[model samples]
Target: MATIHKLIALALAFTALVVVVSPATYKEGDPIEHKSLTLGEVLDGDRMAHSLYDIKFRTDVPSKKVLCNVKYTEKMLDVLRSAIEDLYYFEFVLDDIPIRGFIGHLEEGGFLPHNHKIYLWAHLHFNIEYNKDHIIYANVTTKDQLPISLDGATTPMELVFTYSVKWMNTDLSYEDRGTRLRDNSFFPKNLEIHWLSIINSLVLVFLLIGFVVIIMTRVLKSDFARYNIEDEEEADDLDSDDNGWKIIRTDVFRFPPNKNLFCAILGVGSQFLALATGILLMAMAGMFNVHRHGAINAAAVVLYAFTSSKLG
Candidate 1:
């Protein structure tokens, strides 16, 4: 059985290595522009597999480059019109990283013939971050693009496509690159961490803990006084007086009717609380290295397995 287990584990490790994605390569300052331009709807959907349109790039230098000039034929104009009407966006791949681009806008509340003015986007911008000799991160944005309106020439117009590249030196480690990107582009404004909100939460947690300790301490003090009084007076007097709480004999300390269920619930709660504390301590001791690609979750799962095995 142990031999079989080892073989299975080896097979799983081999499978993982086989399916692992190779990191996209980028020379010191040079970024590779993929030939295929993936175009799709604003939301995630199927994109084009091949390069539908011919795009030429002149790599003059890493800093600036003339991307391409597209002469639109009747068919190309139809495609552009459909994409604009359907709110489709084209994506440019640099270093195997995709950046979304907004093509143009279609006039609403007008007849098809009246909305003949075609606004075409011409420029593309790329921001690449590198650490000394290695490219750490790259992002391409076509947002807030100023379009050149081809007003009169509606049939087949030639559009000159241009692009600009900017390289920035970054001090961030590789593991923190994903976090920086998410915090910059993806994180919602309203959900951002505010100092005021954090302060409020910390105060609230302390207040709750203090309240529980104070309340429990005061309640048990009276019970301790009652115990001393019972020793002097008859014990029957304490048994008859069931109005208030007592830590030893009252309802607060009594065993629940469904004792098994109560024990199970209490045990599970305690285990989870201990598990959380263990994870917190590990993090404080610098156990959490990578914050991306489920590294933290993987660590948590392994810790949970060991803790659970010991408990069992």
Candidate 2:
């Protein structure tokens, strides 16, 4: 009985150690308290009117959406009515830190039509940095619209915002300074490909290559062996109306019409294949900056154009 009790204690200790070593999975914690957000006073700077778009946390009982509540002054409404461009600035407090952002025109168009509800979409960009289960800070800016009619009547408009958050572990033992978010950049700049994804892709490529190799080596070799044997055995029987691929041997080697066009197409295809392989190799080597999508696209276009000479 004493031995059994000792075994149970050891098992419990081992289980606890396993749990401690495992990575943690996070889910959205309780709707972050709305009381944590405080709206500041609105001010007009150089005829540019600014106001807070009070953010509210609605319970799941009704629906899951962040509601914005803002009061507009008559002068502000008048300015929005005639103004060609305007931006509303505001800030909110979170965890005793102030997060600043702005809302303004998202596009040249003043309104967006959706399901009979004329809406204006807002571009909400958050400048935030995160440390795993530790420190999270964010600043937000929006390109949202306030609907106003030519008649000067205030129209009810909905502000739609989309955002994403990236977290990092800042514990000194595992700190990655490159992954740290910058204040000037709204999006995380670190580009990392998970080892699992890379391994899966490599496995798929190897499987496909192996399949092709087997088909070419084993299957084709067997077919060629059988065909050659038939040719030898039926050398004299060939003219006796036996139909096989040997009958079209002459036609199989016949050149296609418009040989120049065909050769050009083959050359272009080979060039493209080489270009694709080089691009893939470069990507694997992390030679290109993945954070700058525009730069990558421009580089691809330039490379393709430069390699076009091989198409000849």
Candidate 3:
């Protein structure tokens, strides 16, 4: 009975380990929480009546189909009337967006009415100003207001949508490059090849190489190989000499064991995984931005220190 209990415990532990290591599918709009602090600001309150808004929310990184709608009473400013149309495109930056997370269809993501309603009350505010020389200043503010409804319970989720509006020829210019880059950057872009496929391919390649080395070593060291094959002249010579013992294949004994090569390959592969994961974590911490000149190196070193704990 004790032995059976031990076996059961071992089996459970092995199963848990397998599941933890396995790669699983994670789509955009999945209920992942944002890890970084978020901030947004509205700039340029007047001149052609421009408005800018920035919002930061704890949300699933790179959410699919981020629906943003601006609601305000229409007033005298003509530019404000056509604010969504005249100004430059809205900029939505995903802070710490997972490198492997991708955007997909809402139905494909399995978001229900309850989840959609959580974002219903969230909105951005646009305050525009027009100056004498046809210069426009826009200050967009974000606000949260729940619609009155007696029937349903309010959603528990807290959401922040960080955004900034820039109106200029340069802002318009970025539309092509920025939109193109953003669209291509997400994970599952090749929707057919999921995370499971990549992980499985790596695991299978490693296992095949390991097994081949193990099998070849075992086969070369076995005694049964001595009787299996020999050139015709060698066999005849053996018989003529009346040698009772069979001659082993010389090819099998010719080479020494290459355990070092096998061990080195395995060890390097494990280290490569650790290094790759650490680099990604540091990148997400915003320590290695090409534009950030101040203390970037220091921040990266500190982040590396924290990640090094895992290796030890």
lDDT of 1: 0.49
Candidate 1 lDDT for residue 143: 56
Alpha-carbon lDDT, every model: 0.49, 0.39, 0.32
Model 3 CA lDDT for position 309: 60
lDDT of prediction 2? 0.39
Highest lDDT: give the candidate number. Answer: 1
Model 1 CA lDDT for position 115: 47
Root-mean-square deviation (CA) per prediction? 12.5, 20.5, 23.6
Residues 1-312 of candidate 2: C-alpha lDDT, one tens digit per residue: 011000000011122221211101101231211121111111111111111222222101122233233334455444433332333333333332344443223234334552222222233443334354323444554433343222433544322333322233334321332233233443355875699998999999999999999877875564455566656556554444445555678998999899889999998888788778777887777665422323444555656777887663
Return the TM-score for candidate 2, rounded to 2 decimals: 0.37
- Judging by TM-score against the true structure, name the best candidate: 1
Better lDDT candidate (2, 3): 2
lDDT of 2 at 285: 79
Candidate 3 deviant stretches above 4 angstroms? 1-193, 219-273, 278-303, 306-312
How far residue 114's Cα lies from its native spot in candidate 1, in Å, is 14
Report the lDDT of model 1 for residue 249.
54
Cα distance off (Å), candidate 3, residue 49? 18
